[model samples]
Target: MITDNTGGLPRYCHPYHGGWDVATIALNIPESRILFICPVTCARNICLNAINGGYKDRVDVLALTEDDIVSGSYEEKTVAAACEILDTVQPRPKAMILYVSCIDAMLGNDHSFQTEEIMSCYPDVTCFVLKMCPITRFSGDLPLVALQHDMYAPLPEEPVPHTDTVGFIGSNIALHPDNELIRILQDAGYRPLHIQACDRYEDYLAIRSAKVNLCLMPFGKTAGELLAERYGAKMIPYFARPDFTSIRTTITAVCNALDIALPDLDAMEAETVRILQECAAYIGDTELVIDSTATLFPDILRKTLTACGFRIRRIYADGVQQKAPDIDAGSIQMPLVRSYEDNENVIAIGMAASSFAGADKTVNMFYDNGEWGHYALRMLAARIRAAYEHPRSAVQVRKEARK
Candidate 1:
């Protein structure tokens, strides 16, 4: 577990030390149009999430099968099939992202060679390879996924002049409310030098010109450290939530770093309090049970729910011991359970695991959408209310119960 300055929850660490292969490839691909070729078994979710996050039209996905794994013929055949698909599709992508699974890594498959062969045959397209290790099975967390993406992205070409530019890094979470940060920065009269999101790599060489680096999330540690050492840029790491108080603190920190006058703290606090109160009213009386195998959102959910006046009855989270101190600080204490037991009155807040566990009512907040996780939190609340007003059908209840 890595602890931040605040002594809260620890940051989650990546499973494999060698770094994530697919994240690197995703970050570096220069072409606007992309294709994600994933190993059939383990990387399906990766491909699906990338596609769902607005990469749908620009990216095509192909899942590799077991026969390919057993025979060692998957590499050539898969590439060829992708090329054929591109040929028939008419408007082919500018580049292809070849994502290897744990099977490929364990089998000692060389994705670089396969990528080169495909690029050579196509001539007009570029290909990059990313190897995804089975982090969950081996080490329990996939923080390296974001890091690998950062690694493969091209470093910024030239440094912006150090006079007034700022860099925003490590904002891969789909629900990251960056608009608030942007508004705060604009109000503070600071012009952003650069803004890098998931898989958006800038040339490190040019990043030093910025006076400071504002790291929105922990994943940007690598880039932030590098910039600090090389370009003398100050790294201001901040954890953002939907609450306005957190936003105000973030703005104050940024202003302090730039030697700008602090904004009106009283007004900011008042506004934040009002917003939180309103949100609480909207979600008051709702009961929620958050379950996460990844452990990325338990604390986040706790804080958000608390702000919105939702009662969290229980949390099914793994990797609590490994999280960074700052992350765990705000985490609420709920009975940790491995499975849903007696969760009749509570609505589940996570992926669709409740359905399999036989929960009467379940809500899936996390779903694979190409590049980001879509927020269905509000939708889940609506459904819960509807279920309270009008119960589910017996047939439908039985169907879900069987799973």
Candidate 2:
């Protein structure tokens, strides 16, 4: 399906950045494999993506046939294919996730009917059925939340709160390994938990023992609710945009949540200031065109960049709900890239930005580089420095490094 307006771009081009969403979370699990049940056409994209990502060995496709559609016998063929997968692979996967594409989601075919039989066939492997339909993006249990809920299901239903342990539930990308937030948590006499560090499934379940849970991403809201409902951990949502005040707010919120005094506020602000200075030095007076499709907080990002000497020509996102007063005052288009007047001079962010404006300097707000909080400033600065020469942006740096 052609999602949204493609801005007169090539029909075959991806609508946005190639994010697997919750499917990418499966990669974090040990000995896990994805059983992608999609059409032959979609399967081709999946196959090529896996190969390009160097994980083709882990992906298997169950392409649907015309006969299967006409006969409506997908349930049987799916079961048979899954059973065949169990018998064929060596050192079998510990978990096999059955992922249905958009077609199946609309068909209203429940694959759970065979869940019991599949488990019975292979008692050793854990199984789950996840919907991979992006069409349900705005609706309840969109792919990201649904997959996260299921992946986290392996953890205990009832978690025990531990005063010393604090957990963060959301995008792993935002939690940098060297995040200073972890240091603050430690100073407040608490250990930090961000799902990335959990190697074992038991470690993930162990989060129930945290005294407080911080929900970072919109998808993480469900995870936070699960932890709170089952484990009774306090779930605090962190949100603010369009200004630098959010950094101070987050720092204060973290302190309050942990029942500790605010950390040296002057010191944290100094760090934020230093990062902003670095960005200003590298990215001067260029008209920047930013898209919200990539970053979680484009409005906040917009205000921050503006304060640091960058001239934003356009913010391609609706800032009304996000409270980006600055963006609302500026040129906030649905993004008419092909009709854009200044593709050459503007610096763009996100794949959507890259698509429309065709900016030579692009900071693709890809998965990993979409940092949150004060640390986000540092990530953006460093990316700008690297991209200053070629204008490839932060995400493009990661992509090139892969080669």
Candidate 3:
């Protein structure tokens, strides 16, 4: 059931998508401070989001004025602001992100020159400039893509080698802590590098040491490229293309590049089957509603879940259309929904879908994040188990998701 909007564009999309986007992810970076240098008006939503996500203190805004815009001294002012932040903030910031808004897009200011001043002044705080122009979404970098690149901006020009380290780049959150991906890497004698796994500048700097990068989500593809260019590591992009058989192939490719032995694929497949059996037993007849944002490929994951004996009611996304027709899957696409009052006995994945579906149970699978491989299965099963204890209101679910 598609709700028609006046324009051809879908109501729920990037820039206006209901849940959190890259800006939140950027602010949540470890050992980093983000100073958003833009209009004060840009402050409210980001601040509210920061508060809700429990990281309000990590972000600050340097509101540029109309006079500054007209005088074209925004760049100079931005440099000064960085210096000020360095002097005032105790312990100093390891890195500062100078986020310029779309209003200043036309200025076409060369940010690096301005940032050089900040670097020269403080010589301690590592900073980079990021353009936050929504208008450039179609033409250039969206904040998500740009943040992925900037996150790696701190990589050292001359990296030290740590052959046993493996980096997981480009997912919003790190993979599930207990994920077999970690087990697989460990069994093969490689350590995993997740941003959150590091607390100090030195540990974070060691991101440069990974022998290979696994781009689990689409957003990470460019980050993987940047890492490859800087560290000469191989890039293996899964990019949310969900299919365990295909994913295993990609993992094999990554292992070959590192000269590490591949994990036991047959055992991996059996473990996945065992979890799905548990999901099927618990799910029973509960309708499973998927939102594209919940997994890298909703359709691909839909196929996988159905094979595990879950019932898919509907999906709140356009992704199913991109794949070849599967008569057996019988999946249908619906636009962003308003209510799912009729579907109470549901297991909803993705915040938007869970909000709309009003499922009795919901998983915190916001925009796929690192929900790939068996970790995806683990997270899904865990959500189902949690719902058995306390169910959430669809109204509460959707409203909280709007941030």
Candidate 4:
């Protein structure tokens, strides 16, 4: 019996990132009504979130269950259910999205055939299918998904545009609400042509037209490379970390690539310094110990947190690919089992359980909320502040206060 914790990776890891092999088909036709069919365990969360984010009217979601997996007739039933839902809804969807799960993959269910059958029955509705192959064994690797996006999205209609717009690529999972990159670009007087990760097919096809591309996360390297090859676009890679200097470096590189005059480094440096100073106040003298199934934000967090005066005692990161050389070596390496003493100062960062033998706090940093990467840093800073302001209750006494 294999027993691996399903909660290893942060839930906010974007669906578009290749951590799960999701297949997408774009119909030239605009989709008015849509349906999402997925495994029972994963469906409610994904569908509800999408609905909360304003896709409810056009979207209908249903989950497949264990019985369906056992019977192998679930696919047919799922299609029938979707059609029924469409009929009940009155206006049928122009496009349908069939989201298959790991069970479907294991059963070797032919989604294409299911789609064809559905099409023959309801010829008016355009149909599409996507597969979600969870990277439980491999964890989530965003670059792999970015490649898949490149492969699945239709080719551009015209030659790549030669505009000054830059392509911003990364898993939407990693983006903060403030959208730091967009702020920086706007501050620097440049307009971004494309900011991918959750963009529609048309936007993806327009990526080749950008004058250059800025890869904010490693997961975008594959897509960036593809666009460069096809459209002569140059790529500027940046990792997530809150260092003002790093941000400045990124901006400089981008400016150079676009032939835009460099922003005053002194001014940029001062602004970054101010942000770090404020961050330091929030993160003073606290110690953190993070463990993740993947090295999503460790490097950036380490650099930024260290600058802000926090002590990183240890990190247990897993599922690291050899390709991510930028990851810090001093941090705990990947594929590690629990081996720490769990001192009072330690606070964990990834999907690892909070109940490890000796840790003071097992904070869950990533989850399906699609805001893990952004929230983790802020949460870390807030925890540190709480600890300093109330040392006696800081260790474990003030759970409600922390919240």
Candidate 5:
């Protein structure tokens, strides 16, 4: 059953996609701490998420009350809070991310004042103003994209000479060193860089020396452009897709940008297809479900898996209608206010689908897990095969996944 868009307000958002939230992503910086200022109501969930992610020690909340917001004293309050944290916190964070939530967006608070005050008080600690404002989502950069951009906005561009470094942006989890992208750069005598691989603030700051920036996700394009404008690095924007054709196109685009010889696409595609066929054969007509959380482009994943003879039972995503005009499987908008029935035989691919289906067999993949090109497709096939061979509780799988 193909569902039509009944656009209005957002109904539900399932919690099974145990990938890192915005706060966790911001904490990716080495020795960095966050001071998230928002209404007390929002702090409950944010604090709990921080505690669960094992970064509670690095997170400080300044819960705003109605009086504090109405009086416009939140700014001063934030300054005091930041000063106290800076003065007492052991070893002192190298960078402080001053995060304000949606209410701050409505208040039209000037963050520069807070940032300036903090820096004045603690000259050694670098201050960055980050917003979690969803109200401005449609106007400028969405919160997540803005966060990605701000994460590296403070790196010094001047006096950092260009090197053989090729920066990979937008993936919280670094691509495996054995990935084809890394192999291509290595073969061309270049070093691949990802923020997740950085062990120190200085290592993360080394992105300023990259000659080229490959943005693996769309949100990273803004950050990539920043690097290009400031550091004169070439920004190549590509998305992670599981299909063979898209993978080839991404590789070709990257090679063209770098003026490097094209890789042997035929051999890579053949190997990936062989893996997919073997996995599909083993699964043997078992119903599979995909969710948007696994791949932003569920339509593409559906086509890729279906071509490999895997039976796609349904796709639960909100925005697949526009891309998938001729939908072949059940298409249900996520976060519906009803309960999902449990199924024993269904093998769910993507955390959202696993949670929604309550299926025993689940593939623990979220946003392709930073995989791109043929490597992504091959790994997906292998994970699916593994899930079939060794079934596990969907809930347990979600818990075990790294945020």
Candidate 6:
């Protein structure tokens, strides 16, 4: 979580980086294989991530040599590597995610050509050309965003007959069974589909039959739009935020999109409030800390927790656009760097925060775990209380958060 004060390459900490990596996300497609074509230096860490992520069996590496790049033979080599995997790998993959590193981007490799060649050779296999290029991190379309879009791009463009099914895009973890959104849809006789819910490639392709596509995160918005345009479904993006007002707005939008009567949220809001108050009372004056590793918007989370009567002592994030001064009024905003002593009284919300503070009381929440609306608030409170009552070491918390 170190801030890059020097404009050079940013530093990466393994333990602090939670949630699924690009390899894991790519492999989410059923019966999929990842062929990462990059120089030896770049492939090492990605291969390690895939191995550590418990998906090494599905991932193969094609290490690029200096001659391959200099002689412009890397493109052909990449296709050959993918074809070799398709031929030799037992029970051929239904889908293949072909990855290229920053070097390929710099050399202007034509990925479309490679994709066409692969598909032409193996018509049964779906091939997606994905970039591992981190040089475009600040660009509008980062690798993760592109991956989300491409993963679903393989879905048929031809219209499928509409069904009561609704698709939820962009969450690595499936929404909780008791989540308000799931409950509402199920009660209304509509089936909800998420990538995590699919056991087979056919189950995933059924997303085209959905009348509406709900995007759970901002990164999945592009994929939702693609589904809507290609399959003629309504695209509804309710990027999850823990705050009550935001949750209400999301619920209203979803109801309007579905043309269903809005469910009363007052009771839900009250339950969330009650839970928060209980947790806060138990937590007392313990110093609470947050970090970006746990969530995309640490400042927004800080504001939500502060408004819920929990006094957040500090926030560790690389960069935060202070939305409001009052929410961050007394809380210290520090860079995501590990530079603190162990403190039993300090409760940390994220792995990075716990690692930095060395706090025993740590809540292991990563990327919100697909939680949203009032349900998210209640779950957060429950986690906070649990962390306080049964303190765990930062290492144990971090390990659980990653899984």
Among these predicted structures, which one has the highest TM-score? 5
- Per-model TM-score, in order, reads 0.59, 0.82, 0.86, 0.61, 0.91, 0.89
Score candidate 4 by lDDT: 0.52
RMSD of each: 8.5, 4.4, 3.9, 7.4, 3.2, 3.3
lDDT of 5 at 197: 74
lDDT of every predicted structure (CA atoms): 0.50, 0.67, 0.70, 0.52, 0.81, 0.78
The window of 10 residues in a row where model 6 has the poorest summed lDDT is: 327-336
- What is the C-alpha lDDT profile of model 4 across 325-360, one tens digit per residue? 554332232223444344455455443423232455
TM-score of model 1 relative to the true fold? 0.59
- Per-residue error for 195 in candidate 3, Å, reads 1.8
Model 3, span 1-403: residue lDDT tens: 4333213544444222343654666654566777787889876787777777777667778888888888877777777777777888877778777877777676767788877778788777778776667666666665678768877876668967757888887776667667776777777778888775566766667778888888766677788898888888778886655567876887678768777777788887778777876877876787777776676577777778778777778776653544544422312233443555733877777765665666767765656655677666666667766764577776666655555
Candidate order by decreasing lDDT: 5, 6, 3, 2, 4, 1
> Which number leads on lDDT?
5
Deviating ranges (above 4 Å) for candidate 1: 1-57, 60-95, 113-126, 135-152, 156-167, 173-178, 188-213, 223-234, 241-249, 278-288, 291-311, 319-343, 346-403
Order of models, best TM-score first: 5, 6, 3, 2, 4, 1
Per-residue lDDT of model 1, residues 258-333, tens digit only: 8877756676556545554454465556465555531245656566556656666655555443563433221222
Which segments of candidate 5 are over 4 A away from where they belong? 1-6, 157-159, 328-339, 392-403
